[model samples]
Target chain A: MALGLAALLFIVLCALPVFYMLGVSLVGADGAFSLNHYFRLFAEVRQLDLFLNSLLLATATSLLATAIGAPLGVLLARADLPAKRALRILLIIPLAVPPYVMGLAWIYMGSDSGIIAQATGRDFLSPLTYSLTGAVIVLSVSFYPLAMLAAEAAARGVDARMEEAALLVAAPRRVLWRITLPIAAPSIAAAALLIFVLALSEFGVPGLLRVPVFTTEVFTAFSALYDFGAATALAVPLLALALMAGITARFMIGERLLVGRRGARNRSPLSLNSRRAGLAVTIALALFVLLPIAALALETGRAERMILALRSSVEAITNSLTLAFVGATMAALIGLLLGYARARMHRFAGTVDLAMIVAFAAPGTVIGVGLIGLWNRPGLMEEIYRSRLIILIAYLARLIPVAALILAAGARQVPASFEEAGEVAGAKWTRVFARITVPQMRAGIIAAWVVSFILAFGELGATVLVAPPGQATLPAHIYTLIANAPSGEVAALALTQSAVVMTLLALFAVFVFREKRLHS
Target chain B: MNDSFLRLVNIVKRFGRREVVRNLSLEAAEGEVVALLGPSGCGKTTVLRVIAGLEAPDEGEVWIAGRKVASDGINIEGPRARHVGFVFQDLALWPHMTVAGNLDFALASVSVARRERAARITEALRMARIESFASSYPDQLSGGEQQRAALARAIVSRPGLLLLDEPMSSLDTELKGELIGEIAALQRSLQVTTVYITHDRAEAAALAHRVAILREGRIERIDEIASL
Candidate 1:
């Protein structure tokens, strides 16, 4: 009972802000009931423009990210590539960069006092940061990890024996297309939809680049203009779009796509054997993944950069760590409840799980917009909206699904006989769950918490719009510093944030390694 | 006459369009060792699960110690409420838990005080001869150790009925013989009604007081092991 309530409390708190956003969006005018705000979106041209921009950005970004990420995923999962571990880590490192930070990095590369201007002695601001192309680049870089991870997961789930059978029958290419890709298509589509939803609600990249999209419009209406009704109306379109994308993604990729069966084969990276092709791909990867960080490092000399970065480093680290801790703890608790609910409530499990997945697909900024629209009204939430509590709520709504999926997968691996053993020992369901279920899922719970922590710490889109003014997180802080400060100062801050993220990842890697050793 | 400890009457189970366990009847008398022996896909495991209330039968009934727990499409009790213990082929001991914790989790709500629970743990551990490995986690234990741990956990609750599903399948030949001897001794000591399922004819012949051979989801023969 205690465990269940803890789980319930965690889920309720996480879900409250997003649910309240929807509830408030439905509130009527004249101090009564109406769908005026929802209807008003269609009547406004600017709202429609912003809606289209968001849709275009999401669709284009998902496709581009998937296109680039799919080959990389295949190389990592199935090929016998050289330096496999090193390349995998290198490809994944870009994920540690927050979306706003990536935008800031691009700004440094393309702004008036930027690297391109400094290097080429020509102003390139017209085609760079302040355009839609910039927004696409930012969103694509921010989300390609989704595609890569999905492809790898899908490829891993294919039974090696099946592939081997195809190879022996002299149908390698046929098997690759028909058997492998089709079997894993659900996961690839799911990844693309996730990226699409993420791009749809992204606000910071577009905001930084001055590309007007729905999320930015909603942010402007609420925060700048203080027009709650107008903002709510604009957000209605985004909400509908988010729901549509989630449903479409769910249909394209089933729930099983989210949870893959871990296989035992040692995945070897693909060999890029053609000399010219190898060099070309390597150069492309280096440009995409390594060049920005390298420039950030070079622009800021190591000594001066370290000194400036260290000044506020302690405070930023503390804030990021604390928020991540809270978010992870909250997410883990909710994950436990959801996992249990899925396991125990067999009949309604699929539907409830689908709802959670859809909510997960909804982006942080969209949730933030919804929260503001809901709470900034002339009502009880007016008070809550003014506090840091609202930001926490936004984080909860955006992150719980991630933790739940991990926990659910882990929970499923536990055989039913363990629970049965407890019951046969005369333990009630409640007691059995506490003594058996909780203990068995401890590692999964911890892993879920860690994942949530990493994601929450790097979250920029929602935090940029929702965080109380001047209370900048690491990502937000770096973004602002990059816009105004010298190249060295900005690079120092970016490097520091990267270091913090890398350190957490290292710790997590150590835990995973230990677990594997223990199991083996 | 008193009823048998556990009974299954005309149980039928189907998956999709195929019937896995066709109208099958089975019973385990008090303190009797009843072994359901069969080849793969013969539905021995399905029948055992049905009796344990883990799987529902499309037809027929189940009784435990004179009480009808499932019958005529009515399942009045779930697996937890059936007071039945199951030992899976994989052991299914919680891998993250210590050996002692494994036993304690099973005996969670029993009125045993902390000291008494510890004593019970010690007794079960000693009985299973796994006392020295009490603090070790399941993954650290050997296959034989896991077999012992599974048995200790199942019997710790003093269940009215016990079910073992291919208990020695994962063990080596040496460990299998050793564990099988220990299990037979433990069953004799506890006098618990047990229904052991195995595909191995030799195992059933060696351990069961009465052995039932199942073929294609139906009973081919049920007789005393000595006569068989």
Candidate 2:
């Protein structure tokens, strides 16, 4: 019953704003329901351009990320490379860096007086540096780690004997092409679709790169132009696209969405020979990992300026950290209940998962517009909407589905008999869940909390749209600061934000390692 | 006066200090069926892998069809270059491929002409009695049909040597007996040196000219099944 209520509360909190905005979009000036907004959207060439831009950007990002990530995943999982742990650590750190910050770093690297210009005395890439192509490149570098992780898991999941069987009659290359890659196709393609959804839903990269995508248009209509009707209408197409992509990705992955690769230690017969693959891997790491962070540092220049900028932005930093803490706690509690319920459910589970995927994929601009429409009017909700709690609401709306999915994967590992034993001891359902299940899922809960914190810390799309006056979160504030603040200060804040996120991730890893040690 | 088509000269293999195949030596004559019978984990399969060039021995030499393919610490030739047909215990049929496609891939590696490749695949599928399921993926086929397709793929290349590692382990008693008979007849007609590894003594006795008993990574004895 408690778990049911958790799911119910999440649905009600999330559905109301979205449905409100959706309903508002359907109403014409006469306030009667109609499809005129959609009609107008299709009739306008500008709207069509928006759709094409988003589609092309998403496709390019998906393709490029996969092109880089799939081969890298294969090497990491199958090769006998030296110092793999360090390499993985380096590769994964990019995942924690927000794409908008990477866009800034790239800007500093490729601008007229930027790093490349200083080094080579010319800006050869200046023209392509802040265009649609730039957005695709930034988003790919930011998102390829997702594909890499998925491909690595899928590669590891293959049984060694499968490849060995193919090897007997075919060359190694043939065996790889026919046997290994085919087995990992579902995972690779699913990851590509996921990247597509994330790219379509993204706001920061396009906004930073000066691309006129739907998300930017929605922000313009609502925040800048004060045209609520146009904002909701603009959000409709992106909402549909995100939902379609999310559902397609979910189906492509199927039941294994929550099930990761089984044995990561399984060895393949194929060996990584010579230093050629090693040289290529080194160049990739340098391109993806080292270059961006180094650019941020080069732009920031010194520790003293970063510290000074950090001091001046103390309010924004505190607001971000405090709200994210509370928001992540709420997300964890809700995710745990929903995840346990989803894991134990027998029917309608797929439907619930579909709903979660759709909610998670809904564009942040759409969610922000929906929240304003639902709660900006005079009421008790208005009180919450005026305070920092509204920001928490935005975070929960964005993050709970992802947290629940993570927890659900963890919950599935536990045996049913363990819960039954708790019930057999005369414990109530809630008690049985707490003592028998939650204890077993401690690592998952901590992990979900950490992810929630990072996402909330870096959140800008909805947060920018919904953040109360004088209470701007750090991410939203840095974005606003970029327009007027000194270049050093903005770069400093971006670096600080990245540093805080990495520190949190590092702490979480340590805690998880300690928990594993204690358990074993 | 010898007909040793597949030879292993005192091969030693280990998995991180746990010795799996210790100074193992065996030879199969041309058109001969030698079954390596042992308990599970006794490294019978490892020896077959060594001969197939899928694995290199730690301390010995392997010669297939009178060419040294592997020696201590090095493999001179890969499995495909050695022209070996191997049937894994789990069948390992390509799940994405049709039954005919599986056979075609094996034949394709040998650079067979496309026109002749179809006929060879059809002939192999027909010999294995799975010609009806030529268009079906591995998962779509019944267990017995899948077993037949595995056999078809292994021999579709007409390899100089064949290795079978308990290909009928998952089938029931009747299916197993039928497959055993089919395999024996297929081997005789193909006239290729074959090595069959299994834990079942009865299977060894039924399908092999000679059965070699293995215990603790060492060969206990080798004798004709009739003599045993």
**Candidate 2 clashing pairs, residues 3+ apart or interchain:** none
Looking at every candidate separately, what fraction of the true A–B Cα contacts under 8 Å does it contain?
Answer: 0.00, 0.78
lDDT string, candidate 2, A381-423, tens digits: 8998999988989999988898999999889888899989988
Q: What is the TM-score of chain A in candidate 1?
A: 0.87
Q: Which candidate is the best by lDDT?
A: 2
Docking class of 2: medium
B-chain TM-score for every candidate: 0.95, 0.98
Model 2 ranges with Cα > 4 A deviation: A264-266, A421-428, A508-520
TM-score of each: 0.64, 0.96
Per-residue lDDT of model 1, residues A184-254, tens digit only: 77788888988888788777788888888987887777768876666666666666777777777766755
lDDT of 1 by residue, B47-153 (tens): 87677665678899889888888887677776556777678766667544588976776665444577778888889898899999999988898888888988887
State which candidate has the highest TM-score: 2
Q: Where does the lowest 10-residue lDDT sum fall in candidate 2 chain A?
A: A265-274
Each model's lDDT comes to 0.73, 0.86
